[model samples]
Target: MVLEENKTSSKAPVGEFNSSDLEVGGVVVYRDRAEVKRMIRVSVKKGENDVVVNQLPSVVDPKSLRVEGEGDAIITDVIYQSKTNYDEKTKGDKKQYDKLQDEIKELVEKEKFLTFKLEVITKQRTILNKFAEQICKFSDSSKEEKADMSEILKSGSVDGVMGFLTAYQDKMSHLDEQWRMHDREKTTLTEQLNVLRKNAQDLNPTTVKDAKTNRCVCISLEAASDTDVVLALSYVVSNASWTPQYDLRVFSNDKTMKVFYYGLIKQSTGEDWLDAKLSLSTANPSIGGSVPELGVQLLKFKQPVVVSKSKRTSHRINYDELMLCSSAIGGGLQEYDPTIEDSCLEELEQKSTGKAIAPIEITTTQVETNWTSVAFNIPRMATIPSDNTEHKVTVTSVGLKPEFEYAIIPRMSSHTYLQAVVKNTSSYALLSGPANVFLDNNFVAKSSLKDVSPSEEFHCSLGVDPSIRLTTIPVKVLRGQSGLISKSVTVDYRHMFEVKNTKQEQVKVTLSEQLPLSTDERIKVHLNDPDVRKVNTPVNLPFGTVTLNSSNNLDWVVNIPTNTTQPITLTYSVEYPPGHVVQGLPKN
Candidate 1:
């Protein structure tokens, strides 16, 4: 953001205002808004001096403005207003706008020429590739067709055909190189046009009937003597936010994990924060300050209310379309160019994970905790443009020793998933957000993290592991008649699950299963096999322990030895009177 200053007498015309040169000092970004602080030094006479801070972003909240400073002056009043002017540009601004327009025209023409050249090159390359393909198929054709297509075949012998292919490959390569060069030049031209257009737009912004509007803060104070006073102003602005993203790197050998916390900050507040101190907060100012109150409840007869449908037209511009226009005019985000190379993130996974790794430059943040929210203050200055794009910053990183285990629900899926349980040891709190999980420096899966305070434990799924195999056998059902007087029917159900651990180390696995719960009094359901008649109690088995809850859900925690196979069986029976039907009973 640029600021201009002009000094005038206190008795100047009513419409004219004295402005000060303000510089952005720092910013505190929250969930939906940011608090910006600006500072300025002003020389005031002994009498009353009105100082105006000009060129503040229009998105600022007028009610959130605050002014604080220490000097031998008595601060009286402060006012914030949206100022509008007609024909505000001077001769110099007009000259610069014309220059930018000329530059833009030149760049656009060059871009058009480059695009046309690239298209020609692409067509030539395609033709060359097709010719090479047809020439290679010449030898495979029959003699009758070869004689008919002899003119199409450039060479007679295999070696001659090979020579033609090699030459074609060279020509195609050269065409491809030329295409790339022209494409890069076109991209460069587009960027130059964007910059020039942005400059032109800044000089002549869109307004209502040629009127330019901006925000300014006015301060009224009385100085004891002629002196220079430093003024600090702060305000809240919207269209700024930060979201949390985490990278969890798991070291399989050490059974440890390192969490690289990052905050993706985005802002379109109409001012760039260049070399400004930035702090990210977890607070949401949009929710308001006071607590919500509940209204009195009333009940009455229901009545239908008729809603009239009326057609209304909106004058607001679509944001996506505006962004496209801005990109074309060099005032918005750049277009996606496929000619540019991708990031080096793919190099993280190679043939060998033991290769030498490059040291990453990591930035640390200072944690500031409060009763309502936690803030991460970046230690260094940052430059963030007002482009509304994601700017990732490293918040902090912590290493944790995690407990590993395998979990499976054979009824749902036969694949066993590896799980990691870790505690948040750092003082900072982990907010709920998306995370990327990497095992042994290779990306495994994308997961989400819940809100975890300091010293709180959390679980992360590390995806399926094939080494721990699980198999589900067909369920067995048996039915028979019992109770001679009533002739009741008894149905028996059995479930068998097999697990084989091929890993060299012993592993612990948790298997979950469920039993049917009876809702009627006459229909009785109970576990017959491996039944201890105890609910909410873990019964010890030879391989593991199984616990049954009131909901008829069973959880078995088993520790399997290396290279060993274990079989788990569960049986339950449902009994009902003759001629009575059970809806969910298993069939043989």
Candidate 2:
């Protein structure tokens, strides 16, 4: 933001105040209002003096202004007001709107000329094409009407009609080239004209209006005998904000992943911040500051009402009662599971039962108050312009030991996705923000972060990997079953998954599969799990019931060794009364 200074005197000046050096100390950025802090050094004589600090954004709320005086100087009053001048420009910048309007007029005339030329070229090209098409019919038309081409050829004497036809062909080719040139010129002229029109859009009738110069903060001070004082001022202003971003990089040889945290700062606050120490906070200054007071409660009696006659269904699906786990598709199916879902994650106090992985360590200089919010203090000062452009600054970097896995849902997608799972082990909380994922120095995909606490684990997608392949096919199918007393019908489907790892290195994969859910007690569904312990060395095991969050789907974490192929099977059966039929089955 641009800044200017103004000083004024009233009556006989009893003291002279000097203030030249003003430094921006810190800035606490909120969602809407930012708390700006500035420190200025002052020296004054032994009597009353007038001091004014000018050049601030007009959006600053006067009620939120604050001032502090050090040393023996006692501040009598602080006032906020606007400052405007009669003329702010010389003759060169006097009629700014008139200048833009003149430029627009010149460009518009150029555009008209280009358009006319393009139309002429288009007409010429159309006529040439028509003549070329009729050239083939000249032999037939000449025999019925005038001199034929054969007669002209027999009596080739002086007229040179052959030269005329050749010249016409040459002219048509030249026009074809000229037509393309005119079209490009027209496109360029149109673009230039549009830019000029946009520039002159705000100037109606070619007149410029005077704008407010700036805002000022005036202070009346009294210093006791040549005292030096330090004054601090802070206020809230709009049009300034910052958002968090992350860059996560994983290496081929290293087990730990590196996370580079950043914040994108932007402002159109009418003034630029130059060489200022920036602090990003997750606080909103507009959320009211006053403490709440308790009030007395009173109760009243009323007549009872009647109930409606609508009974509930017995086969209703209570989605709320079904506490789904955290890994519910990872795409907005956020049914919160009261119980822990990952068999690798036991109780908070107990270690995981699966194969042990390394721990992640975070490093940063940040101040966190709650699990949902944190503030970052930038180590170095920066200069951000007031042009509403993004400027990214590194907040901190942390090293995370993430477990890599390939997750897939064969029914929904044929390709398997690589996922990196890790916990936020930093002392500070990680806010929700956009993240860029990278692997082995190559950019993978864009992801996002959510509210994660110190030890809360979150999933980050590493995009699709082509080395590992999977195929699913129906291996067994059975239909029609009957009994005498308890007559029933049954159908069984056995799905087989064939997987292969073509890469030279071993890969860890997690496959997510779903089973059909039965809402009625009479309808039953069953699953048969095949043992997959022979797949890997320390054999990936199913620690707990993977079908807790869902009645049908199961999750399997597998480690595929290099140049290895394996097959896994899961069977599900549906049974119902003999006379009943299912509605949503495949046509085949």
TM-score of each: 0.66, 0.59
Once superposed on the true structure, which residue ranges of model 2 sit more than 4 Å away at CA?
A: 1-22, 82-208, 211-214, 284-372, 481-488, 503-506, 519-523, 528-547, 550-552, 577-588
- The 0-to-1 C-alpha lDDT of every candidate, in the order given, reads 0.75, 0.64
Which ranges in model 1 have alpha carbons more than 4 Å from their true place?
1-21, 87-209, 294-361, 483-488, 519-522, 529-539, 549-552, 577-581, 585-588
lDDT of 2 by residue, 1-588 (tens): 122234444534332222113577777766565777777666767878656667767667666778886888888766666655434552334366568778778766776776665565555555444433444555556343334434433443323334435566666666667668867877887787777666566543323354435576676777778877777777777888888787787775766677777778887776667788887887665677787999999889886998755332222222222112111111122121111112211112224776554544433456747444467777778887779887776677777889887887887898989888998787656678888887875778888999676788999999988788998775577887867788888888787787789989888776766666777777777655543222122323443223323333566666778998766667777888877767644222
Query: Which whole-number lDDT from 0 to 100 does residue 432 have in model 1?
Result: 90
Q: Model 1 misses residue 63 by how many Å?
A: 0.6
- Per-residue lDDT over 81-178 for candidate 1, one digit per residue giving the tens place of the 0 to 100 score: 67566564544566677788888887787787777667656555554555455556657867765664554332233554455465765656666777
Q: Backbone clashes per model, in order?
A: 1, 6
Colliding pairs, model 1: 194-330
Query: What TM-score does candidate 2 reach?
Result: 0.59
